[model samples]
Target: MENTYYRRIFNGCLFLVPALLLCTKNFSIGAILILLLTATWYLIKEKRNYTLDKIDWMVIIILSAYFIANIPIYLSDMETTRYFKGASRYLFIIPIYFFIRHIVTETTTPRKYLDWGIVVGAVGTIVIAIYQFYVKGMPRVDGYLYSINFGYLSCSLAFLALTLANSSHIKKILWLSFLLCCFATILTLTRGAIFAIPILIIFSVIFQSKQNKCKNIFKTILIMLVFFWGMYAYSAQFKERINFTVTEFHRILSGDVADAESSGGRIQLWYAATQSFIKSPLIGQTYAQREETIRQLYQEGKISDWPISVKRAHAHNQYFEMLASNGVLGIFAIIALIFTPLCFFLKHISKSTHALTGFVFVLGFSIFCLTEVPLEQNLISSFYGFVLAVLINFTRNDLDNIQDSET
Candidate 1:
């Protein structure tokens, strides 16, 4: 009875993770602390040995790689808090995965909690977005965080809800949640998050088509097309953002860099980042060093003056950010961080909804990283660690069951 009661408490905490991740500040940290405490209690009281399997070890290694890559910055005399704090979130995945694996049982599955959390999280995003955009008249619906983070996080939640929709009994609710979350993403006017919409739709159709007939697949595509068309036709902000991107790209191609907008700014940042990488290709430069380089480039007229004036810390693109800040080692660490779990999730995507959720998340996050250094934000890093830990735990359980049966 005690074991059952403790398991229920653990599962309840899991349910609150995604549910409050976006809606409330620091809720995920509190929930993680609760889970950790419970896990520690189990460790001392039961005196049981919980060993990590190969899959768990892979997750730990990849997550740790990002943090390890940042060690040099800490060793140097620089303002390390901004760089180190976000990277430290990766370490949380280790304990989270361990405790979740140790606590979960056949009778008490984690998937349902996660699925419901996604649903609740999606609803919360829609409400917050609507209120911010419609009621408060904000330019972008940032939810509890800033615009870019909230936008991409909403995109990730949308994909999770969609992936689980096929298996869920509350299919309509889940689908509605997915569309609303997409709506929320659109309201943020984040080009990266909006760009992921069609990609996610295609993947959803490709992976989930086996469950439905060809006609249903076609119907789903048609519905999505109409929905997007409606968004384009009706939402002035969405249409303007799309058109502005095209206009900016054209200006860049025409060598009108001074008048170009966000896209052109990104090109300038990328060039600066490339130069920084060339200067310190091995271990990379500190944040202060990188900024000094940018200042020097601005004076030399090699790059524009905007990045300097704004005092932008990152290169806007995550790849460029890592390349400039952490160099070649950071590149390798980030690639492993993205693709290691991605390969694992892809292998099991067809069989497990949990794996599908994991796959969608990594893919969507990769898209976001193209335009923003999302992991630089502490909240986003924490969200990534917590969500990936839960998904990996459930997916690994499925893999283990398959291996056990084969043996």
Candidate 2:
């Protein structure tokens, strides 16, 4: 009876994880911490042996590799530890995953809470973004986090809402949440987030069509196209962002890197990071070494003045950042981190809605990583860890149920 009561409380608390994620850093962290502590208490009191499957072990190993790859650099230079600070969140995923599985039972539908949380998060993001952009007259709506993180996170939530809409009874509400999230993403004017729209639409169509007939697919696509077209036409910010991306690429291709803005700057950072990787491909360059390499490139005029003036440490690209900082091992770890879960979700996607959501989330992050180092930020990493844990737990439950029914 006591255990059941505690479980109910734990399940209720799960809603806060996604609900508060976009609104405040501390509340989300606090919610996760509460769940973690409660789960730990139960684990200690019950003294039950929990088994981790192959995929679980693989997740642990991949997350560990991220931290271990940075150890060599830390040993060589202590000051470089800060660069890998966010890597600690990867390690926390191990405990988070275990505890979620421990508390979320077969009888309890945890996804209900999580789905509610996603809707709340979508609403919260839209409200915050609207206030920031319209009332404050800010060029970009960042919300609680910076513009890029806010945008990509909103995009992720949008995808999740769309996925839930597939099987949800309240399809209209979920669809509305999806639109709200898309609007928030547009408000931020994040090119990477905007780039994810077609991917989301593609995945939505693919998954939704599997459950329905072929004829409905074209109708779905048409509706989405019209909605996004309306968004693009109505939002001056979105159109300007698309135009700026095009102009930046044009300038870069025309051999005027210095004149280009974000795209050109990223290219310069990528070049410097590549050079650093070449020098120390095994473990990659230390933070200081990477910075020095960038400085030298700036001096030689190989890198643009704008990037040099900003003086960012890590590569703007996640892959390049890992290649430059942690070398081959770091890069491999990150790839494994993304692809391992990705493959699992892909395998079970047809059987499980959670798997579909997980697949979309992982794929979306993979896209976001192209232009930004998302895991480098603590808040973003923590959010990723918690959401991934929830999805994985529910996905495993779904797979197990399917297997049981098959037998």
Give the true-structure RMSD of model 1.
2.2
Worst 10 residues of 2 by lDDT: 305-314
Which residue pairs come into collision in candidate 2? none
Residue 197: error of model 2 in Å?
1.4
- Tens digit of lDDT per residue, candidate 2, span 249-288? 8998999987887888888888988998899999888777
- lDDT, each prediction: 0.80, 0.80
* TM-score for predicted model 1 compared with the true structure: 0.93
Supply the TM-score for candidate 2: 0.93
Residue-by-residue lDDT tens digits, candidate 1, 1-407 = 87777778777877787788778876867877787677667767877676766877788887788888777755674554666777887786676677777777544665677678778888888889999999999989887788999999899888888988877777888889888899999999999999888887777777777766677667877987898789889988878887888999889889987568688788888888888889988877787777888899899987788878546456888888888877888888887788888888899997677798888889888889899889768878877877788888778777767777789
Lowest summed lDDT over 10 consecutive residues: which window, candidate 1?
A: 73-82
